[model samples]
Target: MSEIHGSYDMGPSVLSPENVAPKTAEVQDLERILRGEISAVEAYKQVLEKYSTYENANSLRRILVEHEKAVDFWKKQLRSQESFVEESSGPWGTVVETFVGAAKLFGDGPTLRALKEGEEHGLNEYQDLIENGNVNFESESFIKTICLDQQRLHIATLDSLIMMNKV
Candidate 1:
């Protein structure tokens, strides 16, 4: 765990009963982020099914792959820590699907808008963890650098795609 924490006491209090019941706050937080990434993957799949032949399918697929990579990265890390990763995206995934599903009825532009909003929500989640999460040094660095960067790129990509889709 020292490698994960990057040389430290590993934040002893992070494992206190109050801080850890089913799991430590840090692990719980990571799982929550993981679920969001999973939800992103699902939502993209839904959109891709509806937009399979649309001009932006390639862009959506690229973003979907990025989301999938995040999910895989977190799943492996959590498994290595002996933590259980949620098999489903959980409730949050359902909510994302609902929104995107409805948007699909409105048209491709609306669907892209919904996805952009979802990506923004995901970006906000990463920012919140950076500012408020009790994760170790390495985890924080990972979120601040890689995670946040990816979120920004995803959102920007969605924004560009949305504009292209607009008349």
Candidate 2:
């Protein structure tokens, strides 16, 4: 059997195991980020609906637009790489959403705080990926952009919370 790249079997082979390994790893990392973005979208939507009458409702809505953009970007990246895009937030995100729903019972302030914490968590996750070189070079730019956006959202959420307190 002929070999390519000194590792791939080129005879009667339908798939290259060596090539598939790295690609699968990259896809899995990107999918994790995509899932986080999906969770962010859901969390922001819940906050918007629960606090529709709050003074900063419009601000929260604007932040949701950012999360939506990230979601779209990650989904596109996954599709381009021929990866299966995850549509749900998974178990942990479900628990967080449940807590967010409960937080709404207290007040908009608490809900906003919870969202701020979530954004901070996302920012750290992205930073970890970038710092640890978990993302491939081609995907680094997208990950960095998402990290910056998460930072902005976290700061905005904090600002909104502070402003709400002053009211």
Candidates in order: C-alpha RMSD to true structure: 9.5, 7.0
Each prediction's Cα lDDT score?
Answer: 0.83, 0.74
Question: In lDDT terms, how accurate is model 1?
Answer: 0.83
- The candidate that wins on TM-score is 1
Per-structure clash totals for the candidates: 0, 0
Tens-digit per-residue lDDT, 7-95, candidate 1? 66655533233433478777888899899999999999998997888766888898899899889888776766667667689999999
lDDT, model 1, position 15: 29
* Model 2 pairs whose backbones collide: none
lDDT for 99 (candidate 1) = 93
As for candidate 1, its clashing pairs are none
Which regions in candidate 2 have their CA more than 4 angstroms from the true location? 1-23
